[model samples]
Target: MTSKDPASPGHRPGADHSKHNHAGHDHSRGDHAGHNHGPSGEKHGPGDGHDHSHANFLGPNTEMIFALASGAALIIGVLIDNFVGAAPGWLPTALFLLAYFFGGFFTLREAIDNLRQKKFEIDTLMLVAAAGAAALGAFAEGALLLFLFSLGHALEHYAMGRAKKAIEALAELAPPTARVRRDGVTSEIPVEELEIGDTVIVRPNERLSADGFVILGNSAINQAPVTGESIPVDKAPVADPALARARPNSVLAESRVFAGTINGSGAIEIEVTRRSTESALAKVVKMVSEAETQKSPTQRFTEKFERIFVPAVLILAFVLLFAFVVIDEPFRDSFYRSMAVLVAASPCALAIATPSAVLSGVARAARGGVLVKGGAPLENLGSLTAIAFDKTGTLTEGKPRITDVVTASGVSEDELLRVTVAVEALSDHPLAQAIVTDGTARLNGAGIPAAGDLKSLTGRGVYATIGGETVWIGKAEMFGTDGIPALGQEMTTAVAQLREAGRTTMVVRQGGRDMGVIGLMDTPREAAKQALLKLKDIGITRMIMISGDNQKVADAIAKDVGLTEAWGDLMPEDKVEAIKKLRANEKVAMVGDGVNDAPAMASATVGIAMGAAGSDVALETADVALMADNLAHLPFAVDLSRKTRSIILQNTILSLGIVAVLVPATIMGMSIGAAVAVHEGSTLIVVFNALRLLALRNRYAESPVAAQA
Candidate 1:
């Protein structure tokens, strides 16, 4: 049997799963005719109760009602004891006991449950304190203590609900019903019923229902909630070589939209690529929920301390009572002092210090589009001394661009470019996209003859039949020095110059002769240099660049980005080895974006995935995921993690220091009312201190160095 007690750590008060319906019918090619089908074929309209604007949660109304009643009873008991001196003694006693029972009942129940489980928590400490006060004939004071304690617990419950509400609020961003078009007819249907390849029409100001690519029309999309990009990104139909090659049937090869992003002024139709449950928004919500369940290092330490502290305090209080009794002190004085000791030493503030800070830190990071998987990662990020980065997609833009095109003696630049474009257009390599893009611009819409019998030579290049001639494009070594005698000293000099400038040189050949050499470079991000400086400013001493590119290209990029070291021509396993070696000396963080980097990232002390908005693997595997492809977030994450760790330490010290000071005072005859006030005040102080983390802003936003031109 599961207990419904909210105070129990295992009890999740508002965790209701009945609202989301996972079993939904496929509406991809269904003929709707006139009716709209909601979940399970239920008829739905705009006015139907499918609105997700408000997410409901079972609030702390019950706890509030009991606290209010207890407060009223305590007031009346105090009034009767002071003002109505002639009143029956039993009247005040009954009123005080009523307040204590009403306010402390839930706490006592949780304490008993915890005791049965062989665990002790704040509830147990609170119960013992209240009981000891009542045993000392301080009924009004004891009742007051219970009322305040219950109020604090209820407020904390409400605060935590608000924190969780931030995640729940993401669900409301997606409408329950989506306007889906199938068989040339459009109808409203449950979002969960959406399937891949189904056309979804999003009107102006409407939230997207699934991850998809635009098939028709144009619009701006606000992705702040999903990617933390404050400005709306313009979307239009344009050719994307990668997507065009990978998804030939994709309606709009240009624009991509994610679920939960709001459509701007224009109405756009998107073909769904992911289901509701698989959307980026859903993953974020799921991750946040799971993150909250994991304990931080400080929280674990506090729990361990409590395990020893609670038992030791109880024994100490009993020892004090026995010692006083053996000294022939009056029973009243002995018991009163012992009760004071129990009230003072209770670790209420210490118990909540770490979790409160961790929750706020996680929520703050989420607002900035950084998803920290759990508290362990958050703590680990703070201590990272060296950071390893994947060059292509992490520091560079990941999109290669043509820098120089050199044609051999007889081959004209135009002829070589036209043949290269025709052949590379059929390929999906990053270099292929660069060639196609540059060639298309130079051709100016002039049609090039289609390449036939195209074949890709992995790691070398591509071959195709263009203009009834066999054409080849790839590495310089593929053509061979013996066969391409025309590619002499001039070609070698040009290739060396381009490679020295950090460009990837590709050799183009046709009919067993060198046609030309094209230079492609995945340039560093505009913000990369500044971001590296910021990382160094924050005490990240070692910055290393790792890449599968040639050593010369890697060294050039590393020099441009101010990195301390660069490792090139390394395979995936080699990258992992490098990360492990770095981890042997100090805490290391690996930043990467592709599948090849996943293993290395996993091996690092903290794995950070850049541009995780599109990759589900990055979202699931990395310890930290930066939604945007920008490197600027790295320093911000590091700074925030450090701040969180510092705050946790500060909170721990403040809580423990208060206990150390108050325990001695209580044993020396501190009043029960004074001990309760100070104890509850310390807990409140710790909570407020944790809340301060929520106000921490991006320190690099306007830094002088970050703003340098």
Candidate 2:
């Protein structure tokens, strides 16, 4: 069960799986020196001034600034040309020239790249249309067209790049150098030079340089960066060095720490176990970077649309420009109409409609501790009709705790616990570990007497000789043996009641007396029930639990959580079959935390991994990952996706509607200036509409489960 709960519950921010405190990532650390988050929500780090990488349809950094400058010049030129009757003709021409230079800067750069590949795309069409407006002696209108076009692209890119920038921010969390301790001498070396088995000294409040095991000191580690856990996990040497160091991947759980997580108070020395490139944070960066390239269906559609539309528009413009052969019109008027029609029909708004929304939605999800890989998953999440959850780690606490303790009439609770804890301490089962923790805390330093001669009853329980008495702890069947005490009617009834309440029970017997029954249960997460309620409230009603636990236990959890259905006693293949059935007609998403759940997750429309921060398998396999352990993020993610989908549709319909109206209006004698205003105005509308997704509401503020938990 602890396998499902890797991070210790006590060290967790809320001390349970319910709190949103983990949203403060050791991973989402924007607090480090030289990192500033701008009003645009872009996190700029040292050495990462601004990325002017390959031209995004929405430009980046300097391109955005240039676009704004061009807008300023165009506005001044328009004022001089129309309002100031006596203004010098050259003044507006010079201003329009500045607008053209600024507006065409990034567009031409990207257009040149496309031309190099012999691809006649949207950028080329935009440039030709603007140049035609200039050719018709409508220089101010052309400047307005280019200025609006550039400004739209720049603003769209700025808003849409939020997710991409958030991902790059992960790389900035790692320190450039690590202080190495070798042969009692310390020196700072580049983090890349740190290797496996090397010792690195981490000072207070400094980010860890590598994933490694604690060797020298104890301190509180703020693991929000790597684990998305808000509470500071205590770091210290393993109780037994010979054991923890010998195990593989000891960096998992206790005794180990990750790179980029901050150390608190005490300085510590660690033996590096993973190279900087292979650390968990690095893997998340690599995986999500790859996800950015996985294009959404809408993006692919537009790409195909561009291939056909760009060529068709160019041909249509040429035919319209020479329409004197068909219509009784002057070439100048015909050419002017053709250029206006071209500007009207440009797909700039359509091009950015989906990408802008997708980008903003993805970034917003990340900020909320949900990593939405790309647009496809984000779009799919909005339409899911059913959600399948793997029960153990995802829906339940995954770590069993002693919930109820019953004592026999003559036996005291302490006495029963003393004998049982002494016998259970010899076992290595997860249940035994949980029992030891409970007993130790309850005992409060008043220790139990030494026990010896332990003997396990196969398929039953264990018994040990403690102070000349045989103490037994296991199921009721372990009793009524030749020398052991029998579970009387009262004791049997108590056991049955505990089982009916969905707890694993064990009978404690001392000598010839039946001590009592102890009940253990892997409780549901604090917010699990509320999250399910929120999901149903949001119209995702067909919630189901598919678990490897027995039918009884699964049904209990399902009932507690208000799930529509429940299935249990499933093998990995059985889970897959269940998800396949659900996916037949419904858009299904499978959420799980284990590798065993991967098959079923793959079979669903979307795979969401719960508590994916430390699980590499979860990160590699899921379309969306809830970085924090809180179940509240699940509903938040679904709500966000739905909002994003709505925004995308709104932008799409508006884009097409503008083009549809403008195409005919321009041919019907709409001026070039009017077409440019309407066309670019629609483009800006879409960009700003998509940016609304960036301001996500607090999902848990109204959640009763979240509040109570």
Model 2 lDDT-worst window of ten? 30-39
Q: Write the per-residue lDDT of candidate 1 for residues 168-195, one digit (tens) a residue.
A: 5554566677899999999998776788
lDDT of 2 by residue, 131-211 (tens): 887877777777877787777666554444454455555655677788998888999987777877788999888988887
- What are the lDDT scores of the predictions, listed in order? 0.73, 0.73
**Each candidate's TM vs. the true structure?**
0.84, 0.81
- List candidate 1 segments past 4 Å from native: 1-59, 86-89, 237-254, 326-328, 406-430, 443-474, 478-482, 507-516, 700-709
Supply the global lDDT for candidate 1: 0.73
Instruction: Name the 10 consecutive residues with the lowest summed lDDT in model 1.
Output: 30-39
Off by over 4 Å in 2: 1-106, 134-144, 154-163, 213-238, 248-256, 265-271, 301-315, 479-486, 560-564, 701-709
